[model samples]
Target chain A: MKVFLKLALFYGIINVFIEESLFNYPEYFPKTKYDFSKNNLSKTKIELGRMLFYDPILSIDSTISCESCHSPYNAFSHTDHRLSHGINDKIGKRNAPPLFNLAWKSSFMRDGAVNHLDMQSLVPITDSLEMGNSLDNLLYKLKKNQKYITMFYEAFGDSTINLDRVLKSISQFELTLISKNSKYDRFRLGEDHFSDQEIRGYELFKKNCSNCHKEPMFTNYKFENNFLDINQVLLDSGRFSITKNSDDFMSFEVPSLRNLSYTYPYMHDGRFSNLFEVLKHYSGPKFNSVSLTEKETIDIISFLLTLNDKEFILNPENKFPVNKLLK
Target chain B: MSNKFEKFAATCGFFFKYFISFLFIFFTYNLFPQENIEFQATFNNEATKLNKNYSIRKYHFNIKKLKFYVSNISYYNRKNDEIFTDEKVYLVDLNNPKSLKIKSQINKKSQLYSFDLGLDSVINVSGSLGGALDPIEGMYWAWQSGYINFKIEWESNMCSNDNNQFIFHLGGYKKPYYNKRTVLVKKRHIHRLIFNLNKFLKKINCDRQMIMSPSLKGENISNLIVKSFEFKK
Candidate 1:
């Protein structure tokens, strides 16, 4: 019994470090949907993953990284370009969506193609228009790097690198991108006050927008056709390409409104450049249900600005761990 | 002193007997090796020649690219008990004939056994485990988080499209579109499972060439592909 107690004590101490690297959200936020049991967290793995996220070694030409498309600032999304450019100056079809509070998400991609966060990296990594690197080749390249060798050892308890570990570690780092620190979050926690315009906008948001872009997480994560006319040039059929369901035609995943201030050039196609334009587009006759007068639209835009978590964007923890990167 | 000598001798006799028996079993075990059967997959009785045009039910086609996955390979004994074996997922590329061979280290062997054509729903959803199932193989569907179990790209005059292309991306881990199929084989220790693509394409009307999703059509073709693999006699 004493030996068993000693063993239990040993495990208890080990679990503390493992469990500490978890979703560090405020109490006001809803329960996360990420299943922690499948992929357990550890500080070493998350840090390694953060390093991997910032490192261009994951790319074929060592030019682009996960951070290239999903920048640490700008809410981990590219705001300058309407469409994400890849290696050798190749432009991709869709805009790279902002990534945060991903633990609560059920599906990924603007089209809801990737179901798991761990599996999400594979798409961009393998896409010829994007990274243009095979998982085998990427693994081979990372395996050759001594820095990654040490990091993989520290993260996985062995120097050997595999796809599962690499992907899961990336997922771990992405899972820590919790953004429950905005003025809206403070209001929920009773730590701050909102302006009357912000309050009115919040009320309007609850009535009209909250159905698709649900509360707290700010997304229901389901594909819906907002009746955007198909781009005759691109001929991108959105969710219809994946599901082949006629109802899914011209539909897109309801993007979270969090950090809209940083992640500009909005919509799946990056059509709208600002919140007011987005509001005007949504308020059109196609979406008569979201009828908003000019003042209400501005008020709503003001409320959206409150969703931008500056702390999250500038957080040092989410950036590359190494001071100097390999050229 | 005499009794002590007798005891020592008795102990020596016992040790020698056991040592001789151990050596006998060890040498015999080494002499006769357990079966480690390697299956070499071929398409229509040919791998290298498959890039050429072939006819199936009066429909002629030439394989531009042909690749598929075979997983969960194991051997079975006469008693119907599964021989414990290392689980391996093999990505077979008919274009590269060298990639067709799959070796399995198995115990409790028999001549007759079956294997999975593609990863089951479990491995399909479990995320990357490297090797054949790795996303690098181009077999994985990033959009839907599953694998394209079987793929065949060909140019056939039977296809009505201008390109005369017949592309089949058979996949789906979900119900009603589950694409994994099992094939039972016998008659040889080193199995030669023939994947007759002609039989598969014939099931689907040549006019309807493209199948890139999990649907009733894909499921029907996948079933036909399973039946198409002939065990070499």
Candidate 2:
């Protein structure tokens, strides 16, 4: 009986490893661009990352966590806020973009500044207007926490918490945030059917928006000049700030059209409060390349909403660990 | 348990002392007089360092920030065939004078070649990395997907805009605009590599000071910065 139990345990471990290796996407979805070979995923690492994501110990004063701005209820994007608020009610310059299906993103942020998801966590941690904490100090705090010490040991053998492990673990949790079960996804797989309006909208989307916002991922991952008149108070030049080239002036990363309903107020600055305003803005003279009628606008918005994955947001795996580590 | 830990710590302390002595002997394994390969990024001369007024391009200037990356520096044997050790990339923040001096390791008799100066395109796209390539260094572009191989910023009376600040953020990792550069020093066999910021600043026009992307103009600026490195006598 003891030998049988040991064999069962070994098989269980193997099953967990196999599940971690899977990208959790449909066959139609392209191969994930994330180089997971560097920081391979495991249940322990993902759990540790989830705890870190929810824990406020990463902040200078331990007042805010990654979940503060990126709440899971709103598709991992905070709702009803244009600009993100960090520690001490400090207002950030741009809106917090939704975090999901990150395995496909080659670059991150509205400005397309950060390339890899692993290093992406550092921006908010060190930003003076954001978390306002240093990496060295944050590591010291993590080392002090006994629970974190055990978690680190479990995830990355021997409990040494450095930049590589911290970033990689967080990435492991983030990579699991794959969203492939939307109404649109089911429609594509022939498991379900789209409404007539949604089908019409999809057609319009292919004709107009697909040039920039490509399929499957709904983004080409390139910076383009959207020609949004610069905000006077918070003057953001988009990608030009990073590149400083005049040609790249007023350019921003083409955001994914997925989960649009949950990720509103729209645009980089969160200017439009709703999809109607966004459609109206695009219909205006700013984007003269394509014009949409009132019915077409509604139809496209209807199709965009079909991309929302309720399962991705409400998944038990992605939620706060209230019953597990926190308790 | 407390009593046991205290006894264990005492034994550890005894071993630590012997470990230090052993390390001293291990480091001095070289029979001949040992030499160190040290590199320093210099500004002006010995009398002048950062935050102090200096003259370059025939104008008064004081650096507010100066950070750049040097990577894959390898030491070659006398035949220049075999490599001693691949030099890990290091970000030299010249503003803090202490960060200027970098001590390197090489085989005793081997002569060193020019260090691979900046991050290559491969290193930029390789996702998250550690040590000097760590994202916390502030050399990586905050928004874009590439590493900023070199960053030089200063305030000068010569500049007219940006509060008289001259800024150069040079990096890119893609076709046509590839930004990572390698500086090869073929001639001098020296123990020190000196980077004189004065030489770089001498060529800069205050009116055209700002460059944040990798372009033809940015490439010229980076090439000039690479030219600033000199081996000490």
Candidate 3:
């Protein structure tokens, strides 16, 4: 009996340790806007979501997956492609934004159309240019698969796979993508020191870019009109499409500056291939314009590079689960 | 032998407890009579069946789909005192007979006076709901995160585009374009709440048949939908 009690105590400590490790961000970051109480994070659910994220079965034709455009290597943001490419080589209207630190965001998409992370996947799944699949069709396919059935049962404690469970599980995996291990984070923690150029760049960044981009999380999580002349072809009318308000006509969700090195081909339309173009646009004729010299832009770029979380980008846990997914 | 006997006794006690609770619940449920309130979609005072051709104002069309959400049902007694309220949202689809009827616990003396034509703002932002509110139900708009309050699909020669299709998916939970309307009716119309599409179809401007997104048009149509609801005499 004493041996059994000791074993129970040991098991309890291990369980607590695992649970605590499930979600962890820096203490300096603001409280997450996502209500975790609605769909509490669990290891099984996250693993299931990871499989779903990597699997192409989520698409209508078993061709495109979330990872297809939002590749984990490019900090979960596709590079080279100006606009997101979906099944049948159909081009999406907007760039596939990088996925990280999503819990802090109250809304999703470039237009801030999706009000919740749980519902974000539905947009991509059903969009005719994207996956071109419906929730019912996706659920039907998932239910037919033996692997998904077992995963659903393990994640939800039932084999009955519904739309809510599928969406919630996908969100669980996305919420785990908290990029808080950048060089700037270490600098804040007093573990690292910045060089003279980096320090100057940091100061410049604080002065010019911190208002919309903000701190720690690197985004104020608000929409901004960055003054990219609307593409005559795409003619995307950003947040105005969702809210139908005139003020939001050119406004788009301000993206986070984290993992800038990996996530290139920036902006809503992926018009800028590098940081120089983006800076130039800001310095040009635009609302809330900032005038910056060549040296100032270079210095700011150096500081922005420090926001790249190398550890997060290369983290094997965030990558495809080859072993489990294959099995 | 004693351990086996104790296990058997414990199992029996568990069953006995559940049995007693079940009996109490059964009796309690039977004590109060439940009421059935049904939403019927009608055209010219007749059941509106899907794919049936109807003519109105030189436009001959058949409704391919008609679905709407009826929520926040409240019943009032003679003195206008709130007797019972049902917070459950019912999705009434022309294709599905099972979803047309809503079961509520109400005193026979009470009558439903008013109900919401669509899901409220709270449920709109709640995110990833199950049952009738689930996105798989096809009532949810994928582009914008909100439940479609009402949907109308028609195949008509009046529409100039897309194989002569006229569709209206009216819903917006946000401010300035809030489309959820409160539908009020006479107390006598409680049992069989009717939505006559003849009154609504006459108002549809065939020139702009596609109102898929939330706009002033959707808001205006939502108001017209509220006006279309009438209690059966």
Candidate 4:
């Protein structure tokens, strides 16, 4: 009896170690691009990250964390607004993108301005129209909060606030925002069946859009000239602005189609309100590139609807950590 | 009553033994040295020389910040023999070559030291903003995906009709634009790989200061810099 108890205790310890080190995602998804080896996730870090995500301490007026624009209910994206609004109702240049499965993205922002996930938050926190707060000032503010001090200590093994710890904590939380248990995922797992319409849509998507919006994760992770006409006022040149290459003129990073239900106001500019508008744009003469076919367009739209993962948006664990924040 | 007391004593003794063993193991792990080393690069302009004719400027470039990961850095001497191996952090000052410092954060761990040298396994070449942060400064180009790795830029006021700006952004990572080459330095007895910046400038044949950014082409003259350096003792 004593031997059995000893064996069980050993097993429990080993299991805990394994669980802490590994993140479990659906097998269909490709390997994550975000280097977890640099940040390394922990329970404490995730909790601290969640708190920071909801806290407005990151902004100048203390009105925005990452969650202000990218809310969980809307699949971590802003709703209705074409351009993202920040502190003092300042309008940003681009749309607030939906945040999910970021571990797979090699680059961030619609333009891929930032290369590493760790440095992505700095752009928003420092952008004049966005948070309008410096890293040093934000650190000073976080230092005053006793709860944050303790939380930071627990997450990073040191309470003395720094940009590295702050960014890492937020990254830890964002990395956990993995959305994979969609209807499509269930069908892939052999545990559930897709409706005839969804199945037909999936076939159409593979033929028309699968080259760019590849399956499993639904993104080729490449920049493409989707043939979007230059908006007259914005005149945004997309990837060309970053690279200064004529070839990259108007090419934008291909966004993931997952959670399309909640993350409406689609595209880099957020010009389209619903899926139908986006489909209409694709069906127009401008998008009549050699790449897409008319029949394939409708089927792709059907497959996009199936990409919505209801369980992810409603997950209580990912919601505003009200109790922790209140404390 | 005596038998029950003895059984309780045995259980208590067993618990104490396991607890002591666990403490020993924990302490042993914590006692070891675990120090992390980091590298930083610095750039400096020594002599700011401005031209009278076209208002073109020249500056002597020096290392501004020297940062690197020396934990896995290996050094090979002239004879290609391994001399030293351990975790060490080094900060190299390009202007003051002799002022090298080695400090130990953790006593039991290896000491971190830096050197002031131009070219080693890693070199810092400034041409593009993206190239400055690359592990190897060899890849510097705007058109291609990867770094050009090595190139030079120079400003000349003597070459053009109105003394127009001269620019030579060399080193191509792709074929057809391929300009990188290895030169054998017989004097140093080391295979000194020289990026022939002069050769590239000759090919372009326009002795004009080349501004790196396309937007700044006519407004400002581009200055390209290269340093002759090696690992020091």
Candidate 5:
């Protein structure tokens, strides 16, 4: 009986290790930029991160959370609102970009201000308009919570909670947000086929948008000027604000085109509510080369719809921890 | 013969005393092998204490805080050959007296020493770090990721704002605004690295009292910081 119990315990440990290494992505996806060696994926850590992502306790007044803006059903992006609403109903300057395929991203934020995914949560947590909590205060509150202390001990080896553990655990959950089961992915794998309109749209996309919004992952991960007219109210200069370089004026990160059906309104400011409106802006007088006919615009929209992954959006694993959080 | 014997005995006694003293020093040094590199912040050759009032050439100010990072400290020989390098980053703050002194295992044979005033690009981009490089230290910038190389805040009448405050946070890991400056001291025997702010304060442009981000001004101020270091034997 003693020998059997020891064997079972050893098997459980092996299972945990296997689960940590099981981060599945498509074969066509490029090598991830995130250094997984620093913060290895673990079941406990990912679960802890999911809870933290959904928890409003990260805020000063415990009123706002990451989920408040990034809803799981909407491909982890806020919908309808032109700008992100934070704590105290204070609106932010830029749109809340959807959270997916973060492992491949070299930088975070629309302005490319954050250098690493592990460090990205610090911004929203500390921003006055957003969570509005200082690091010291946040740590203090987490320390006081017995549930967090127990969860932290399970995730890490010890119960001692610090800024690094909190940030890294959140990153582990985000890294798992890979949208690789789209209709486009299936078509690439020869499991599905695209309609004639989608094929024509694919050709048009190859001709025009593929340079910045590349294939496989659907983004080249470069900051480019999309020539959107500056909002007189916001007067926001995108990447220029971070680098302080004149040439980088009004340039924002080229967002991944995956899960577009779930993630809208479009653009950095969420100015366009639909795909046709986004295409209209691209086909405007400023972008003469991208002048698409009305028929061509409709075809492109049809093709973009194929990129949406319902499997990813509705995945039970990606949703809030109902059992854990509620309990 | 007796007089000659007395002379020989006296000579042996003289050499024995010298030998005993040498043995004592060698063992004590080995017991305490850790060498220290002490950083001192001074205003006009006097130690600059936190929240202390300082006046120089019509500028009256009280230093609320002064903290900076010193990283990749290395020792060199007379021929400029690298001897030993301490691959640790230290947060030297005026408020923390113990943090200002960094201990290293450097030999006395080293003729020169050098260290970067800020963290290298590699560390700046590398995810979350603990200890001295921890974000909780208030040295790490959250909105835009990167460590603040040098931070100095003063309550001064020179500022035109409602609150009489002048602040400078200087750091940038990416080019062409990379602000980490290498400071080399030719004398390695002098462990005291003094930051004399007498010249730095006088050169401050009072009109632009606040500089919190990376820019041309941050780069220029970083250069001045490299020049501000004075060695005390």
Candidate 6:
């Protein structure tokens, strides 16, 4: 009896420690690209990150936070606008990308500018045309918040706000935005079945778009010259602007095909509003590039619809975190 | 009554021992410092004259800071007869070659040392936060939505009507464009490679102000920097 009691106590303590230390996800995914070893995730950190995502404190004049462009309902992507709107009603060049399943992404943004998730938030916070806020000023604002101070201390042992802690906290929350419960994922896991049309669409997608879109995670994460003509006004050369390689002319990051239903205004510039428009663009003379066939384009669009995961978008966990913040 | 008392005592004693063991494990894991090395990145421009043709009147060169946490830094001596090892090596000031310093943090009980480099060791040791947070790094180019890890800007008279300017923004962190380079230092020789920024400038003959993104140039600046790194005796 004494031995059993002692064993029970030991197990209880171990369980508490395990629950506090790490986050475990499903087994089907690849190893995460974000190095969590440097910035350990805690419950408080995730909460703080979520609050920051919803708060506009990150922007200049406190007008826009990450949520301004990436709303929760739209899978953390803006729905109404083609391009992202920044502080002082300024408009950015590219469309805001949806946020989800970030752990698998090796880079951030449509251009793949950031290599680490911990550093991804800096892009919107500092762009002169974006948020237009400096890091030091943002830290000062975070420090002023009594709630943030307590939360930061809880998440990172000390409330002392710095760039690393702020970035890491936001990363922690973003990592939790995993969208695995989609109908497509259910079909993959044998939990559900697809209709005949959906199955045909899946087959067509595998044949044509899977080369770029891939499986489970919808992107091969490669930059390809998708053959979209350069916008004379934006003059956005896509990947060519970064690499300076002529071959990369008109190349863009292959975005994930998931959440097509909610994450509308597709493409890098959000030129296409619906899947049909996207199909039309792919099939039309606009795509003068040597990439796709008409039939293949239709199939790829059909397959993209299957990527939508309603359960993820509706999850209350990822919602505004109002209760926690209010306290 | 005596037997019951003895059983209670035994259970309490067992619980106490387990609690102590648990505390030990918890404290040791959290308190112990794992081995890590600190690295610094510095930027410098050694160009004396701006090329007229390239529109580059002055060149501004900066090195992006990076930290490589290694278990040990060991090399073979000149004769290759023996191996000399330093457990910790830090990446020091990357911009200023003269200010770059790598120190080994030594473990008192073992052959381990903490390695640190540069003046802003702590800040540089932290990681890259894209364009929003830090501006000094120049890791972001908003029009492209990616980072230009290394940027060199120069004033030139090549392209512009008025002895104009030339700019080469070297960047691209993603696939087919990831520009991180590696270098190998031989045991005893000073291996140095010089970047001929002037050569690229000489091509245009100071006629047009050249605004060139290195990503567009297809030139490997990483290769230039890696080759330029030499081993000092």
Highest DockQ model number: 3
Q: For each candidate, what's the DockQ?
A: 0.47, 0.43, 0.70, 0.06, 0.62, 0.14
Q: Order of candidates by TM-score, top first?
A: 5, 3, 1, 2, 6, 4
- Per-residue alpha-carbon lDDT of model 6 for B8-110, expressed as tens digits? 9999999999999999988765564232222222123343222222223464322223222222343444444324445432322234443233443322233
Q: Which candidate number maximizes lDDT?
A: 5
The 10-residue segment of model 3 chain A with minimum total lDDT is A11-20
Error of 4 at A23 (Å): 2.9
Candidate 1: misplaced stretches above 4 Å?
A1-13, A322-327, B1-67, B71-115, B152-167, B182-217
lDDT of 1 by residue, B1-233 (tens): 99999999999999999999999988766654444334343445564355586766566767777788877766678776676544777788866656766655545346567788777877865655666666767787875788998887877777555768778899888775778888776543646677665555656676467888788888888888888776663
- Give the least accurate 10-residue stretch of model 1 chain A, judged by summed lDDT: A318-327
| TM-score of model 6 (first chain only) | 0.89
The lowest-lDDT stretch of 10 consecutive residues in candidate 5 chain B is B156-165
Q: How do the residues A1-327 of candidate 5 rate in per-residue lDDT, one tens digit apiece?
A: 999999999987876676556587778889889988788788899999999999999999999989999998888999777788889999998889899999999999998999999889999999998999999999999999998999999999899999999999999899899889999999999999999999999999999999999998889999999998787899989999998788889999999999888788889999999998999889999997989999999889889999999999898988999998888
Model 2 pairs in collision: A112-B143, A113-B143, A113-B144, A114-B143
Residue pairs whose backbone atoms clash in candidate 1: none
Cα lDDT computed for each candidate against the true fold: 0.79, 0.80, 0.87, 0.61, 0.89, 0.63
Give one digit per residue, the lDDT tens place, for model 2 in A1-327.
Answer: 999999999987886677657557888888878987687778899999899888888889888789988989888887889998899999999999899989988888888788788878888888777788888899999989899889999987888988778888899899999888999899889999988999999999999999998988898989988778999999999988876678888899998888888998888899999998988888889888878999999999999999999999999899898865566
TM-score of each: 0.80, 0.77, 0.90, 0.64, 0.90, 0.65
Q: How far is candidate 2 from the true structure (C-alpha RMSD, Å)?
A: 6.8
Better of 2 and 4 by DockQ: 2
- Candidates, ranked, DockQ: 3, 5, 1, 2, 6, 4
